[model samples]
Target: MTAADQPPQGGRGPRRAVAAAERTRQPTEVRRRLIVDAAVPLIAERGYASVGVRDVAAAAGVSVGTVTYHFGSVQEVLSEAMVLHIERYYTALSEAAEHATTAAEALRLLVDALFTEDTDRHWRMWFEYWHAGEQGTDEAFARGQADRYAAWHRQIRALAERGVGDGEFSCDDLDGFTTRFAALADGLALQRLRQAPPLTTQEARHHLNRFIERELTPRSPL
Candidate 1:
């Protein structure tokens, strides 16, 4: 019989009570979120290679068996945590970029949002992801990274297309513009994170804004 099906042994009152309490504990979804929440920060701080199922179980105040049962393996748990992190990051970016009066404004808001302290942990996790990919230690993580980058490019391209259609900006080559814009933003973020030449958040944002202004010509009013 499974552990859940096993009855209290030795006919002890305390043992039976404990078993009943375990049965009535939070539902699976709640417990799974607890484990993922616990893993996110640990993975961000320690990197995936340094953390394990036991660490996540301890952080979530659950048993190792519970973590294993919910996620099946340490890699699964880490993957879910990274997915959660990326989802939240993308949501924030989308919200910030939406409803902007112009594409230039949207791009500026995105750049500013990326450099904030609120996103520092997410950026750290992203770097950890990149390191894993570079080492060829985690194929799943590398694939996830590629997918996220593609999603980012799609979002940026949509913004560029919107700008052109609205006559707020002019770009002869949307594909080339999107590629260069994304590469510049990523390079700036990595430089800021590494403190190479020590760029302030404002400076980085300003640099991006200038690049946008230079690359996209404002449409002449009819």
Candidate 2:
């Protein structure tokens, strides 16, 4: 049945009416941004693969028509949501780096921020994007993955450069370390986020810290 045709179950009113009632009056731009923002939690909870236009619309407290009116397709909404979600991830790391006086301090803060209390959901959306790219299922997902990976690589490389400049960290192959470290973090996050007790966040961080100590620590002057 159509949204309007559904009867109120359990006396809470119909889903459509509830959605309409929950969303207060807002400007068009704000509503559009809210729609994108609303998709983030849904993606985290349900996985991006299971989130559809109807899901986004319901999560945003808007109608399916409204969602389509703002976006060309659900794919567009998903792609934008991916970008929005990653902004916080990058921003936290950047802030950690910016606020620190030393590269070592910055690295410690970055790792702490990386393995946050809520990292499971955050990493779920990311791995979903990565799987989409690997499967060649979505062109937009593939393109966005490439762009985001480039940014991630640059962020890691920039930190390495800062370490080298400060004489705190040493790396013979800056580019290689940047790529490998990113991959390593990704792998660790995936492990921690997975079910069946793959690994704990503490173990993951310990492993990553050991890697940093071995690879990035400056050598003694000979």
Task: Write model 2 residue lDDT over 161-190, tens digit each, in one string.
Answer: 898887887888889888778888988897
Worst 10 residues of 1 by lDDT: 15-24
Sequence-dependent TM-score of model 2: 0.83
The lDDT of each candidate is 0.81, 0.80
Clash-forming residue pairs, model 2? none
Which stretches in model 2 have alpha-carbon errors above 4 Å?
A: 1-27, 135-141, 195-197, 219-222
Candidate 1 lDDT over 71-107, as tens digits, reads 8788788778878888888888988799788777787
